[model samples]
Target: MNDTNSLEPVTAAAVYRAYNGGYFKTLVSPEQTGGSFALLEMVLPQGAEPPAHLHEKEDETFYVLDGTVSFRIGSKTYIAGPGETIFAPRLIAHEFRITSSQLHFITLLTPGSFWDYFMEFSTAADAVPVVKAPTELPPADFLMHLINRLNSQYGVKLV
Candidate 1:
């Protein structure tokens, strides 16, 4: 048997869009039971982001597929462009924005459960507006719920 067959692929077009944030597609999710990891493809238009947050229990990695992004990984802030990758150790505060209108990237979140958490939180009860164009950031409460959920359920803390 081929080891590759044990895993399934999550097409970029199938996943849902971000609510009042940006765009995202799950390349691999828990539904596939593909292991303890998950991958997501994201497109962040200019002026969009998830707010400052952290994942204390989960290790997240981001690899820029295209364009430029202003990323905040812990106390440092920098622009990561195509081919660059950023790693956020557990418990570190982090967030990012698409500085240019065409920023795309691939993110890997260890322990696939984060994918499930995001799907549930983003769909059932989110405070963002889901605006079609770039706009002001969402309120702190909006991000708090998301950050708190990740912290409580997945042990991810937003400092």
Candidate 2:
């Protein structure tokens, strides 16, 4: 998983820890599966949610492992907890926040390379981080700049 980018027999994944203490790990990469999908596990603490946004080329399905989440997917709004699932289709505006103490969930994105966006912030992990980082976004000016650049290239729009 770490070196071969495979999940055939199971292994640890490379990790990405955002400055805000959110984590993303690709368990199954698009390349590893011949471009079919990507499986990512994320660990995010309360208040670490993105503004509503939608993907133009990929649909996402999330399966929660622990904690609680509040979601707004298209016209629907709901809360999900451990063992629950939620799907956000391409072109549907969706966003979720960790509503409980923290959320640990697995998200499945289908039909291509959306994983590349997360890869831009990821590093091959030598060790998974345990300490929590600041929850604040980068200074507003810098955050907007970064978000604009990525959203354009990734066919995503913040709504």
Candidate 3:
């Protein structure tokens, strides 16, 4: 177990860029939190959205910081703006999209290991500002293979 008593600062150089013009800053990683939870801040451009997925072992919470976002949690949909928060329980299918030009939010996942998924899929090339549509994204099978591996390793399900 790791100590959670120390202060963790957010550094500009620590941002992780996603393939779709989105940026992630890991605030409290699993290793830092004793595997209890991980908190990350994400900045997503308009039209940015993640495929619907569920965590088999981690509950997720999102806190909107700027702009607006559309979130689909299970059968319900929600439009959240700055200062709002949303929760997605473990085992529930959920996805979110940036409804405004840009959206910033903080996501916290319980049990922490899911943080590796973001780190795994990110690359240096993603630092370049480029937003592609879902249709223009990478091959589904390839992504699925990676997702499956992550699921086996981290207990996340890309459904």
Candidate 4:
């Protein structure tokens, strides 16, 4: 085990622009936490939503920092605002959307893995920069295949 006591801060310049127009900044990664968890800060514009998905190996939690957002976990839907938090356990289908102009939130994943998935998805050559609502985006079979492959590799199930 490495010394987890060491302190280091990740800066804004490290943020990655995801395909859904969200900005993700990995704060604490698995390597830093001795594989216990990963923490990230994400900024999402209105109308941005990732497809509903579930993790087979990790539990995810979100803490809203600003604006409003909605989450669908299983069969229930909930709205959250600044200073609110939501938890989605492993294996339960879940997804979130930014309801306000923009949303800023912090996400933590136990048994860290989603960070790698985000990095992979965001860095893909075919990943488009989403500036508006994702509803009009054309279907990209190749992108979906790549996403599925990466999801499988990261223990994520896109439903």
RMSD after CA superposition, every candidate: 6.2, 4.4, 5.2, 5.5
Q: What's the lDDT for all of these models?
A: 0.71, 0.79, 0.79, 0.78
lDDT of 1: 0.71
Report the C-alpha lDDT of model 4 over 43-95, residue by residue, as the tens digit: 77887776898888999999999989889999999999999999999999999
Considering TM-score, which of the candidate structures 2 and 3 is the better prediction for this target?
Answer: 2
TM-score of each: 0.70, 0.82, 0.77, 0.78
Candidate 3 TM-score, true structure as reference: 0.77
Off by over 4 Å in 3: 1-15, 124-135
Candidate 1 at residue 31, lDDT? Answer: 65
Ranking by TM-score: 2, 4, 3, 1
Decoy 1 TM-score against native: 0.70
What's the residue-level lDDT of 64 in candidate 1?
Answer: 95
Give the clash count for each candidate.
Answer: 5, 0, 0, 0
lDDT of 2 by residue, 22-113 (tens): 67777888999999999988887777677899988899899999999989998889899999999999999999877777788998989758
Q: Give the distance in Å from residue 12's predicted Cα in candidate 1 to where it truly belongs.
A: 9.5
Using TM-score as the measure, name the better of candidate 1 and candidate 3: 3
lDDT value for model 2 = 0.79
Off by over 4 Å in 2: 1-19, 131-133
Off by over 4 Å in 4: 1-19, 123-139
User: How do the residues 1-159 of candidate 1 rate in per-residue lDDT, one tens digit apiece?
Assistant: 438658565443345556345556678886676668889887666665666777655788899998898878878997899999988776788888777776778888886777777576554323222435555656899768766677678776555
The best candidate by TM-score is 2
